[model samples]
Target: MKRPKPTRRKRQNLCADKGYDYPDVRQLLRDWGYTAHIKSRGEEQSERKQIPGYRARRWVVERTHSWLNRFRRLLIRWEKKVEN
Candidate 1:
């Protein structure tokens, strides 16, 4: 299935974790005009480390994902209706 179109304002930034560092995901974010702040696995190394202002927000996203995973229906896409 194709992704839904975003109707929000422009220049919005998306903060995600290292798991989302794939090329296809980055390309899709670019196609939607979103500035991706996803951390790369390699960046965890001492030589590549750099402090980012949005680094504090990464934990929040990770926590939300973990919480969502607690529900079997949502985690496995068992729910069909959006309002369900």
Candidate 2:
């Protein structure tokens, strides 16, 4: 699959969990013109205690996966034919 090209008009942002909190990943994101919003391990927990109504970036992605999992067909590969 082809990757989408970054637009110069507006800046792009990449939200990821602590697992991707590496120097290489940060450099790659910078090269790709994305504003990385990756937090270090335990950073989110500390912020959550101090800030009210603070939400982690990964929460949205996890919620989306939870919603998608409700659909049995999508959770499992039931279609053998690509046209289906």
Question: Which candidate has the top score in TM-score?
Answer: 2
TM-score on alpha carbons, each prediction: 0.42, 0.51
Q: Specify the poorest-scoring 10-residue window by lDDT in model 1.
A: 46-55
lDDT of 2 by residue, 38-77 (tens): 9998987887899887766898898998888878566366
Counted clashes in each candidate structure: 0, 0
Considering only N, C-alpha and C atoms within 3 Å, which residue pairs clash in candidate 1? none
Please write out the lDDT profile of model 1 over residues 1-84, one tens digit for every residue.
985455446566789998899999999998887889987776665433454443446788999888877885565675666766
For candidate 2, report its TM-score: 0.51
User: What range of 10 consecutive residues in model 2 has the weakest lDDT sum?
Assistant: 72-81
Model 2: residue 27 alpha-carbon error in angstroms: 0.2
Off by over 4 Å in 1: 1-9, 47-84
User: What lDDT does the true structure give each of the candidates?
Assistant: 0.75, 0.83
Q: Best candidate per lDDT, number?
A: 2
